[model samples]
Target: MSLYKTEAIVLKYYELKEADKIIVLYTRQHGKVQAVANGARKTKSRLAGSVELFTYSDFLLYQGKSLSTISQTEIINSFASLRDDLFKMAYASYVVEVVNEFTVDEEKNEPLFALLLATLYMLDRGEELELATRFFELRLLNLLGYRPQLDACVDCDLDLAKIDKVKFSSKLGGVVCADCALEDQYAMRINKGTVATMERLLEIDYKKLDRLKVPESTRQQLAKILPNYLQSIIEKKLKSLDFLKTLTMTN
Candidate 1:
């Protein structure tokens, strides 16, 4: 067994037994890691706060045969503000859930780690939650190599600006001209405004996302399309997304 230290964000956790919990973290160096936090369930346990969802911390982990164990941890940013509000918590949950679903264990992705950290910080700081989430989703898709073609048709290679109405093929992984889209029966009609919005979301830096404004119609279009595209890629709906929709409807 070997011991190492790294920075990580707590994605999710599950009770292991009576007092221990299995923490799923997206570490800066280690990617996704599942570590046991002994006595974490007990009141006054030092690991309890550090292991909470969306907490970013530095950890000393002992690598073992089956799972690693957290030996020591220091809180980096608890993102406490996220937990204090229901809306923030729900959006934050969707962010972490996307990370958890897309990533695999022990696969290091520094860009993805940075994106997640930046996104959480933005959400916690009271940025526009829907816009931030959409930005994160677009960026995440890019990082995962599922970036959709916005500049041109995926099938005909025609410039999208020249086309009036376009369709997005989740299977083809980009936009297709109306003529080309006919070949792909699964392609869904996408508005030019929505495509522009998606492109802008992908291009803008996360720090600048606060200044970005998305119209309600565009936001609604994206809200319907992005999740379906993601589900097509991931092969299942995210539980957090369903909960998020419910929360949005109620509020």
Candidate 2:
């Protein structure tokens, strides 16, 4: 059996027979990986902490025909805060879910791995959840080649800044000007502020996200549009998304 090592973040996991677990992780070198952690469910298992959701860790694995086996693991960051706070956990979970849904197994995407780590760190530090989410959404889309045109009309070259009204069409994959609204009759009217907020989130460094204050209105608008836009890409809603909505609605 060949052995390998990688730095990975635990995306999710499932229980196995007795004291084992089947873990799903997104690695820096190898994109998404699924491995079995023998005895991980035991009290004294070293792999226990590393298998928790969102834990960043170094993994030693024995390659298997069906699924690799996690031979060893060392925790880099448990991201305790995300687990301690329900809201924060929900946000972090959503980002990881996005990563899992958009990526395939063993396809290397270091940028995406870094983005997930950064987003998790932001949530752990108690930063702006909505802004962080928007940044992750836009950046993730861009990295995956589904980048939506936020600068101008998706149909024409009409400058959005000079326009008084704009509409976002998931079908067209960007914002369309008023004149082009007829192109996608289902396009939803969008506010300039929301568009600008999305633009800033896409352009600004995530570290300086705090400097840009996002109004509740913009957040609400994003809550409506961005998630729907993202869901439109996948066609089926993510299970984590429904949980997130339930959490938000209850609180």
Candidate 3:
């Protein structure tokens, strides 16, 4: 066994026993980590607050052959505001869930780690949640090597400006030019503003997301297009998405 320290954000957790918990963390130095946090369920336990979902903290761990043990923890940013509001909680949950789905254990993903931290901070501080999430999704896809082709047709080399029509093809991993529409018959029809929004999202800093105003029509298009593209990549619908859908219905 070896001892090491890292900063991580709680992704999710489960009760391991009466008092212990299994915490899923996305670490800065280590990608995704699961370790036992003993006595975390107890009200008096020091690990209680630090292990809560979305808490960014410093940890001292003992790496074991089969699993790691969280020996100590200190909260860096609790981001408690996200848990206090249902609307914020729901959208942020979807964001973290996407990160959890796309990553594997023990991989060092510094860029993704920074991106997620920025996103959670944005959510916590009450930035425009919808636009923040859209930015997070686009940036996350880029970090995971799944950046969709927006500059030209995924099926053909043609520049999209020349084409009067463009359709988003998740299978082809980008927009298909008008000439290549038949490539994916189920391809999503996209408009100029929507395409421009996505392109801008790809390039903009997540912190400056507020500066880019997204019209409701474009937001609706993004709501449809991005998730469909992600579903194609991941091959399964995220559970958190269903939760978001339910929230929308009740509102």
Candidate 4:
């Protein structure tokens, strides 16, 4: 029965009854929260626009025994441009969906929230969407304590520079050189440039992601492969990720 205020990003929502809506939000202080917004489905509801997916809002919430209730919400930034374009919206949805998948209730995840906000801002401003998405994925993995190794071989500790075809092993959490990968059945072929691109992405800031120059083939490869790698670790396919692919196909 205590009321609290916080800045939050609406991840997803669903209609609950004729007038109420259930909102899933990732807050700055509170990791991920599920709350019911009474009357939010009505045409004139004060929470209508503010509760939309991917919108950043300042919310006044009341704690309940089961789920919290959002008493009021004010839009801080609608990120209106993200909604205006399909590419932006699709990528933004991917980011939100991944966040929703990785997190649980009432945990303070400041780093992840900041990364998502920065990523959404980059997507909204019309940056290179592909690069932004990949970068977001890498950074998100790092924040979640599952950072993949890119420096050297996990087995012999050999530098990967001299290798031609690097072996990326999900079991080992990164690239293992050709020699080391020989013994491991779980390793897969990873291009040198792709490995380099992944390393750069891990270190670069969101503001400079557009300046990166990765080839289309490399980008496509990473885009296809990285998610599968992540899925191995995360143990589930994100629904929004599938929707994003479908949106791209139909467009």
Candidate 5:
């Protein structure tokens, strides 16, 4: 058919019949793309390095009837450091997994693409990995139109700053004031500190994540809350998250 080129980060890959591999990528221009890397499993295959998970690369693709084929590739940033550390790799995998699971083929989302790239860069460079992951989750939710309302009650629309006790309702999708909590029986009590942390994380730039200190209690609160929020949004448990929890517990 036709040939095209674009910048992409390899999300994941699976072995194909014989020496080929099926690569899932999130491209800067094309959103998510699935393509075949012919003979990629073979030792001498040119696509081997370019198609590895988390590798940012430029690719030449051949448009086919059912799937695109990666004809040529050049490495941009392999994010080599992620491979050197188990924890970093696990976090990175969770990031990519979120991108891969939530996105649809060829759905162009530049902000999402940028967020993923920036997050990977932070992970690779050894920045605040935990904060970065939380920030990414919050931002990703906003970008995808699932942003939780933190400033006010989801039901009554009252400003949370004026409210003394605020409860977070994952079912209602945001903070609920004391009066509104009765309406949402499943609302869980959220400490003011964790609420503040979430608000700050949502507003701060990704570049400054390392500068934002999260107290152990706040971090634990976030570690509990954000994943539950994300799981509620996605409606299923993330496999990578299970592995990440295992890694965290072991370490």
Candidate 6:
């Protein structure tokens, strides 16, 4: 079998027979990979620490007939601070869940991979979780080709400056003018500030995310609308999301 090395982030890990683990990882070169790590679950194993969740590692793999084996794993970064607090851990988990659900193996999603790593690093360092989440949502949509229409109305092509109410249409993949919105009944009305917030999110980097002070009302609106829009596009429910929400409420 062929052997290779790559930089990877542990997305999740599950116990196998007794002392082995099935690890799902996102790699910089190979995209996502599912590999078996023998003896990774045993205490005092050399691979045990490197295979922990949210850790980034350099891995040596042997390509097997049924599944790849993790021959070796060297820890690159552990984000150990994340394990100290529940909020940070939960936020990081949410990010990982989204990455795991949305990405596929060997797809070469460099941007998405970078985004996840950056966000997780930030969360581990105790950045504002809400801002990080919003940044993640906007960037994720952009990556998936569901970039929202924020510049102008979908139909009338108005500058949006003249429009006070922006109607978002999942069908049209963006906002539409009141008159233009008649074409799609599923559209929801949003204020001009919310529209502007969406635009800023698209243009700005995650580091500058906190500068945009979105009101609770606008945040609530986006919290509802963006997820609904994603669900419509993704066409499936994510169970990890439910767990994330529960953790958010209790934490």
Candidate number with greatest TM-score: 3
Clashes of each: 0, 0, 0, 0, 0, 0
Which should have the higher TM-score, number 5 or number 6?
Answer: 5
Tell me the tens digit of each residue's lDDT in model 4 across 132-195. Answer: 8899899988888888888788777788876667878776778888788877786877787888
Q: Residue 193 of candidate 1: its Cα lDDT?
A: 84
Please provide, for model 3 over 18-47, each residue's C-alpha lDDT reduced to its tens digit, 9 standing for 90 to 100. Answer: 899999999999899999999999999999
Q: Any residue pairs clashing in model 1, and if so which?
A: none
Clashing pairs in 3: none
Reference-based lDDT, each prediction: 0.91, 0.89, 0.89, 0.86, 0.89, 0.82
Give TM per candidate: 0.95, 0.94, 0.96, 0.92, 0.94, 0.88
Which parts of model 3 are misplaced by more than 4 Å?
A: none
- For lDDT, the strongest prediction is 1
Model 6: per-residue Cα lDDT at residue 131: 67
Q: Considering summed lDDT, which 10 consecutive residues are worst modelled in model 3?
A: 242-251
Model 5, position 60, has a per-residue lDDT of 97
Ten residues in sequence with the least summed lDDT for candidate 2: 157-166
Question: Judged by lDDT relative to the true structure, which candidate is superior, 2 or 4?
Answer: 2
RMSD of 2: 1.5
Instruction: Compose the digit string of candidate 2's lDDT tens values, residues 1-251.
Output: 89999999999898999999999999999899999999999999988899999999999999899899999888999998888999999999899888888888999999999989999988899888867888999999988998888889988978888767888988889999888888888888888898988878878988999899878887888887888888889887977888888988898
* Model 5: pairs clashing at backbone N, Cα or C within 3 Å: none
Better of 5 and 6 by lDDT: 5
Which wins on TM-score, candidate 1 or candidate 3?
3
Q: Model 2: residues >4 Å from true position, as ranges?
A: none
TM-score of 2: 0.94
Of the candidates numbered 4 and 5, which has the greater TM-score value? 5
What is candidate 2's CA lDDT for residue 233?
92
